[model samples]
Target: MHEVLIVGGGTVGLSAAVFLAHHGVRSLVVEREPGPQVHPRATGVGSRTMEILREMGLADAVNAVAVDMKGISLGKVTVETLAGADFTTMSPSAQVYRDPDFTPARMRGTCPQNRLDGVLLGAARERGATVSYGTELVSFEQDDDGVTAVLAGAGGTRTVRARYLVAADGVRGAVRDALGIGLSGPGVLGPGINNVLFRADLRHVIGETRFAVCSVTTPEAPGTIVTIDGEKEWVFHTNADPAHARDVIRAAVGDPGLEVEIVSVLPWRVRAQIADRFSAGRVFLVGDAAHAVPPLGAFGMNTGVADAHNLAWKLAYVLRGEAGPALLSTYDEERRPVGALAMEQALLRLADPRLHWDNDPAMAAERARAGVVNAPVVQLGYRYGQAVQDLPSAEDVALDLDGSVGSRVPHMWVADGVSSLDLVESRFTVLAGAEDTAWASAGARLIDGWPYGPLLVRPDGFVAWRGTTPDDLPGVLSRLLHTA
Candidate 1:
């Protein structure tokens, strides 16, 4: 039996497999599609997601092909006066906020979905994950010991058992449905249309601008214009009826529009939602299967990627006997709120019509300050709250150097030219203050019986329990490793 079976081979599934394999756990991926469908969906990869990819050793590949989005441009086009509309370009300002220390590592990169999937699939394969394409999980049954899944594919049908199952099967997940978990929020909003995967020769019209440009059309038709895959590709997202979407796009671009080639037109609706629960028995949900948000801040895919990373390490610990089953409960507790917050932010942006620029001097300054300047906090400054803890007061929890537990583990320049993230591979890090040498030693003894290596790591990079001390290590470790 496979150690774990991941349903779907998209970004979340592939990322989970890669992380599990890197930590010496075997996993299998079952995808309905034969290969990556580089749809124009989810084009931006956030910085934290890139850091996780770097840990998986796939960052270089992603960075090599990604388009660096320097900035954004907003223009106003009224149906009554479309001829002489003013367009304002907004660039990144010098005043930095939100994790300025990680500035060198904090930038969003864009790659087509296909290219992103290719890099992840390659990483998963290299880490010894068995990826079976065009395979559908027909059904599954779970027990205390393991899970049995019936899969249907080109060859026919087969039954495979696994220790655990993770459903990354997008929005319409059979596993989630089978578990009787109904979607628990407002349904998708107005019928929106996205003209994805299309090609156009508008290099001369839009010029060398690489980042996304938002064009505010008349109230009759509002949409976003973007370039994808180094081509003049436009994703026209309209709030109007899908039937009238084409006409709206034609009107926005005007006649003699630089040779527009229509490719695939995908109709979508915005939904802000999360599953009732993240786990039931041995089954767990991740990615779009667990929660979905409007695409305003590009949080949908980024949050899913974070879910995979957070759960991978916990699963590795439990499977390796390094931690007890109680550790698994932290998965939903830590990640569910994050998904909720992201959804709230996306909904707020969508409802705020002022986000669409009006080109007024005051409006432009407000948009620049709110949209561009304060974006990093929404993108990265989220912190874990009561979801992951049972403490009565926040002071009980040890804060990172940055005083934010939800903030990413601060990236430090460790020795050997490697990052603090680079140093945290295949082990649980225990970062303690210099005064806590005794606490560090106490932690090592608790991990002696555990399966994985015990890293009695310090707040800095000094090892407090590398066979140097033996005073009350077990008690300290137990306290540090205890869960609510």
Candidate 2:
């Protein structure tokens, strides 16, 4: 029997497998598709996701295959097209938005989804995760002991028992339906979009403006042009029909002479919704299976990877007898609110500038405060405070981490090219000022002398608890371990 059985092998499923294996827990990832999709939508990988991958020793491998779009103009020209635009007309950064105070070790990047899937699929197997493509989960039953899943593949149908299951099966996947889960929130954010994958040489028309996303505001084919390879491969996401998508691309680019070949046509919906519950007994929903966010902020897979990172360590501790089963409860509690908060942000972005959307006052006010888009704050600042308890800090603004219990530990530099985050990579770590000896004197591998005052850090790099007074240290540690 497998310890963890993951259904759906997209970025979410494969990433869940990788994170689980990084914690020394083996997992099996099953995908319904025969192989990688021809065109995947997500392009931007936030810095925080890059940080988590780095901790798993995957930064080099993933970065090796990624396109560094940082500090490059994302959109261009008279307004949106990539023609006759000056350098100043270009945008700030390509992928990771740089933050002065809390910048991580990695910058954001863009990689083709199919190539990224290939990277993750290879990396997961290297880390001892079994990834089976062309496999489908027919049905599953869960009791107190474990979950028995019936999976279908080319060979035959087989029953596999697993202690836990993660549903990365996407928004409309069968596992969520089989579990009888329902979504809550505004259903679809906008009209259905058609992703028209095509190969075209745009060097002549692109000119000096470089971008991963170029908005073509032409009345005929008004949509966004996503650069998949920064070269030949591109995806035009528009409302136009596939039969006329090629013509739309030509209109958007303003170059009818450019050679374009439509590779695949995929219909997608922009949705902002969260599952009523993130879990059912031993089964948990990760990625789109739990929440559906519009692509405006590129929070789709990034949020799901955050879900996997938060859950993997907790599952590891429970399975290793280091923590109680109660630890698993934190997954749903912590992730659901973050998921909802992210959905709100996505909705806000999608709701903006569109006369068709109904703008709630609160959302409008928040949007006004967050004037122009600042991607870093949205990516690095969200907390899973709900994991132990749902505590969204109303007074807390984005982009600042002030030693809060449910927030990411403030970053700092250490000697030997180590980061403050490196301390909590594999297990629970106690972080204190460099001079503080109380934790060390107690014979714990005290990560002596850090910025924060006696913070209990979880394996996932979030602060579990903190107390400067140092009273009831053991009790506080015990409580946090049990609760988290």
The candidate scoring highest on TM-score is 2
lDDT for each residue of candidate 1 in 202-243, tens digit (9 for 90 to 100): 455445544444454655456665546444565666555545
Q: Cα RMSD to native, each candidate?
A: 6.8, 4.1
Score candidate 2 by TM-score against the native.
Answer: 0.89
C-alpha lDDT (0 to 100) for residue 249 of candidate 2: 85
What are the models' TM-scores? 0.79, 0.89
RMSD in angstroms, candidate 1?
Answer: 6.8
The window of 10 residues in a row where model 1 has the poorest summed lDDT is 392-401
Q: Which regions of candidate 1 are displaced past 4 Å?
A: 71-100, 103-108, 216-221, 239-250, 255-257, 353-375, 386-407, 414-417, 432-473, 479-484
lDDT of 2 by residue, 1-484 (tens): 8899999889888888988998899999999988777677787777778878878887777777776655554532233444433445443432333444464556435777777777788889999998888999999999998999999999999999999999999989788888899889988766788998899887776644456666677787788888777767788889988888877888887776668898998999888789998888899999999999888777788889889898898888888877888888889988888787667767766655321122333543454464422345556665665331132333233335656878888777665657778877667777777577766754334454555678777888888888564666677767656843
Question: What's the lDDT of the predicted structure labeled candidate 1?
Answer: 0.64
Report how far off residue 375 is in candidate 2 (Å). Answer: 3.5
Model 1 alpha-carbon miss at residue 328, Å: 0.9
